[model samples]
Target: MSTSPHILLITPPLTQLNTPYPATAYIKGFLGGRGYTVTQADLGLELVLKLFSKEGLRRVFAEIEAGPYQLSDNARRMLRLKQSYLNTVEPVIRFLQNKDNTLASRICHSRFLPEASRFDNVADLETAFGTMGLSDQARHLATLYLEDLADLIKETVGPQFGFSRYAEKLAMSATTFDALHEALQAAPNLLDQMLLELADALMAKVQPDVVGFSVPFPGNLYGALRLAGRIKQISPATKTLMGGGYPNTELRTIQEPRFFDYIDFLTLDDGEGPWLRLLEAISCQLPVASCQNEQLADVVQNNLATGNRQLATHQLQRTFLRNALGEVEYHNSPQPDIPHAEVGTPDYSDLPLTEYLSVIEVLNPMHRLWSDGRWNKLTVAHGCYWKRCSFCDVTLDYISRYETAPSTLLVDRIEQIIAQTGQTGFHFVDEAAPPLALRDLAIELLKRRVTITWWGNIRFEKTFTPDLCRLLAASGCIAVSGGLEVASDRLLALMEKGVTIAQVARVTDGFTQAGIMVHAYLMYGFPTETAQETVDSLEVVRQLFAAGIVQSGYWHRFSMTAHSPVGKNPAKYQVAPVGPEPGPFAWNDLWHEDPTGTDHEAFGPGLAKALYNYLHGVALQEPLSFWFDFKTPRATVPRHLIQQALQEPGKPDAARPNNRLFWLGNTPELRYEAGKKGQQAVLTFFEQAEDFEVKVPAPLGPWLQTLLTSLASDYDTKVLLKDAAQSFPTAGGQKWEQFLLSAGWLTLREKGLLVL
Candidate 1:
């Protein structure tokens, strides 16, 4: 065997159907750039593609028929239409992938697809699809058809089958590994069998010396372990490693030796450092096949220490391995994590891009963006710039360790990703994309003339001025989602959100005014929040929707996690951590008694119903009590709170000397014409679909023309507003500030001029 081991990275099944999660792609890019052989795959998409094909449905039908389980009317109806399903499944798959658009009309009109239980309760077709094109309409129907089959699988052979998650219940806040371990020990279910088959085939093909699974969610934990177990059975020499969002938060204090029976190493926090160290430890003098868990720990502890000074004392940065004594041992190396800039562009090379299913499970515009199409996932920065939100896992490395790359470097990666994937869409998966970083990124994208459509998360800071929002939109930002968590000002301050209801209203209104979609993440439960506060928060959300400030929103029931501020010191928030008690395997989410809050659980259904109606443009005029079955406190918030907030005039711009000026519209054509007093300069500007003219005296015209031209130049120019003002011509004794209020200047400002 080669002295250097090849790496195979994978994203576990059922995280997403519309896009490949970026974890494996990121690792593959970083590791492969270091000249380490790396191959990556999205096993979820592969398993999905395999299970939903014509032949796959034949197998599914036959398997269900062979089984001895009671079938629901839906399942029975689907089974009866098995032939029709088998005939249309492949075509439906093709059409959903945008490979066969010709089938959309037939699917919509010809009864080409079998109607099943999933279609039984679909909302009015006209209301849902009236504005959507034919293709989108058909895609939603195909999505439901798949859901119908998914229901059959879950109800019969695979109770764990879900489009977005697998065995999630077993892993959600699973403090103990007993249930997960027991489930793993059982015989493979149908879905598990399919996953194993994919993994086995992959291992046989790659024969990699190391296999790493990126488990980004609780749903992925079981899938990762299940496949890692199979990898061990196939090749004990193949080192199995697991790390990601799940372990980063859940398995920090892992003490279960049984967990190591599945994977050789479990890494916490950022994986890049730990994986590099772990590899050095594994590539020891011991023969690869002979290096079992105990011997591997020995190699990590004894051999690697002598070989590498950074790994002295057998340290592996933030990693856990089973020791020779049949116990789990955590190891750490002092080596810092690989810097964000140094980690190369995420490689989407080995992933089956076109094969990913773009399923539409939701009808709301902003919500459907998650499931509608592929978006090249990128990061604006390494971590959250504002990591002070009490409810957030701000203490975790992913949030706490903030870092940013240069704007040019970020755009360089963007171009590289677009070139590779042939996709111009991006989703910056940052904790909260820093506002200043996004500004620079947007400017860089414009300067480089990189055309792309993108969106990401951000904090509702006042820095997102209307002008700045327009600047972002000009650079192709389509939508942004941010936390409007606990809209009550008191609770917001308690959570350290650094924003109030009025501030969110202004910022979201700014984004909306700039023609960008805004989605708000709202929270219901918080310490010291009363029922009246809950009602008021709902009222605020309702007005936000009614006033068209926030286009979409989601209300989350607050769950305290161990890494968050509140979870760490519950007493400070006037809450008690009534926990299952931290156990050996998984422990992050802490059950807390928010003694001062209302019955949070009781509001979940009403909140969901109200939000659902609001999303669909329904029931906004109904009383807040209409959503809740029980009597609720009357709204303390005013009827037009958001309207009044929106009506409030924005503060005048402060033209700081260093503030940059640029033109986002097309270059203007300057000409001279007759004026009342003298020759007038007329600058004709062309926007996307319209053209307008700005007139000024000839002398002032040339000066303004030159400034606008320089600002709009293809090169990345730094024409500060102060610099432009200082260079103003003394035409008719018009002051620089006076000229700013002129119709010509105002028109230019309205037509895409940005002073940011």
Candidate 2:
């Protein structure tokens, strides 16, 4: 090989406005670790920055005025205020990038930012934010202001224009490649031209031998192919590839030869194995047939027949390539996927870490985390530990194959990421972060003094005790989200979610009590879900919100997918598949008619309305029927169900002796204070917000002070509960067990003492 092929990874337009999607960073890190020259770009962020600039607004206004198109009242209003938008666009963008903070009060005023139809939601804006945060309120207003320009663009130049997605409708549920192919074949629109120009400029600069597009969402699919087409035309020698969330699930059964015209290679599941093997083939400059031997094909066929994925690691993993005969060929290697520990820390070097815009679409505390700030995205582990959820694509490799890295390695990675990004906010993009691993990682972060604010998804398992939640919060975990899908116990059991409504209530309450906000992923319209069950589910959610157990939540409509258990065995769930039949391209997201379930479409709006009110702490006391126009069954759930569950005391600290004993507060300073017994020993804890002191007689105080020192997170040795109990010093015949019930111990417990 002349030289190891220079690889370029691009995150296509568009995904998030706040943070760069972790897919490319992850791939770049692993590949860079392997001694490859890998550079990366976030075209999504680039496009947003370009499209929202002063010059960009001028072009948009020009296009709208010149085009022969009918304008909505809002579009006309924005057109009338064109100069206002042009003047404020650049400053507003800079402000959103966190480069300007003095403009918040001005934007909060009536006339600072240009207003259009998007400003009509003034009532909801005021209600949602009140006067709590001046900057955040300004951000919300600026978001709407930008959205007004987006509306004008959609009406005049680019019909598919969106803040987070472009031409997404063409790719969503696109069972065939015809629509996407046709769009790519058509002349580029103003937006598409801008995307291509940006891609072309990057390609010219990098001049890479291979261009890899990370198509994480359906919206990204079109842009990836469009960019690939441009790269093929301008630099014919360069190879192209596609991977990430979209192809990992949707394009597994691809049979379209036209699809390969844009991308030479496409990978599924984790990219580590397939990418290494593909690079080997590219180094040899050989075709697909020359690369994959006959025995490898035999192994793939054999594995498929037997439903076995664990095989020899020498072959190319799940990949799609076009052969010399112009036919599609699929190759799945027998080798095991890379271990999670070996994937290396996600590198954010090539990405513009500071240029991303932090747009605020939602105002609530837990909800705004998604779109309001940059988060260093990392995965605690690979795959879901519990992959039995019927509605999920449990059969997919991304979920079925489970692996974990040690907490020490995870903390090392976390520290490395913080050093690279200079941002301490992390979003653990795990399917479900293991509780024990999080518990250990929390301890490691505390031990190393690596402070970061983080959040992640998890199953509401009973293992997340109040003490564990406290440990996580101390480690800077500000929020957590878990699926409380279809709150009916029967539906939960049917879906194999392994969590009941009562368990969710208890878990969410533990997080809330520990000062960590919780967001529940609510689901509706599970197979065989009756009207009564649906109404009852709403009641459970209401109770969760009313009791202040859950701070934020969302309702999701269930869609059976081809890889899910329900799609595989619809008879089991009593649902029938409605046919569009599998086409020559995309194949996930199966259409189904749940004959045994209620009219799910009818309940969607009502469920959404009720949730919208619940999110803002409004209309919570209203009757269930008040949310819907149609007569609905009364909720059968008891009013106190959630409260009762929250009140249920879990196992006490005395029951778990093997658990680690930790001191999160400051180290105590020992001194003598005047007392009845001449001079008693007093220990003072100088905490950040407040300071407190405890006094005890003579030897007991000195011994307790030494124990607290050893229990501090900075200490190397761990002190177990049983060992700590055994070492307790008795005073006035106060035994070890008696000391546990004393005010001194309880006060210490309240002041950051943790038995985890």
1-756 per-residue lDDT for model 2 (tens digits): 135778999999889988999998998999899888899999888988888998887877887788888988888888888889889999999889899978888998769898887778664556667777778888888888888888888888988878777778888878888888888899998888888889889988999988899988888988889899999999998989899999988899888999999998889999988888777656545222222334455654555466564323345578888877899888986877889999998999988877887787765577689898999999998999999999999999889989999999998998898888889999999999999999889988888888899999999998898888999999999999999999999999999999888898888988999999999999999999999999999999999999998988899999999999999999999999996698878988888998889999899999989998897899999999999999999999999999898778777777888988888887799998777766677889999999998766656787888889877735568789899878777553567767677777888888888887
Model 1 per-residue lDDT tens digits across residues 1-756: 434678899999878888889998888888778777899999888988999998788888989999998998888999999999999999989988888989888977778899888888877767778856777788888899888889999999889878777888889988888999999999998889988999989998999988999999999988999999999898987888999999999999999999998898889887878877777666663343222235355644555456532222265789888887898888886777889888888999988899877877878788788998999999988989999999999998999999999999999999999999999999999989988898899989888889999999999999898889999998999999999988899999999999989999999998999999999998988888899999999999999888888888888999989999998899999999888798988989988888877899999999989998987778999999999999999998989888888889765434455777878887788899987887888998877889899998788877877787887785476788788877889864678777777888888878888878
TM-score of each: 0.96, 0.94
Best of the candidates, TM-score: 1
Q: Assess each prediction's global lDDT (C-alpha) against the native.
A: 0.86, 0.86
Error of 2 at 697 (Å): 6.1
Candidate 2 positional error at 216, Å: 0.8
Q: How far is candidate 1 from the true structure (C-alpha RMSD, Å)?
A: 3.2
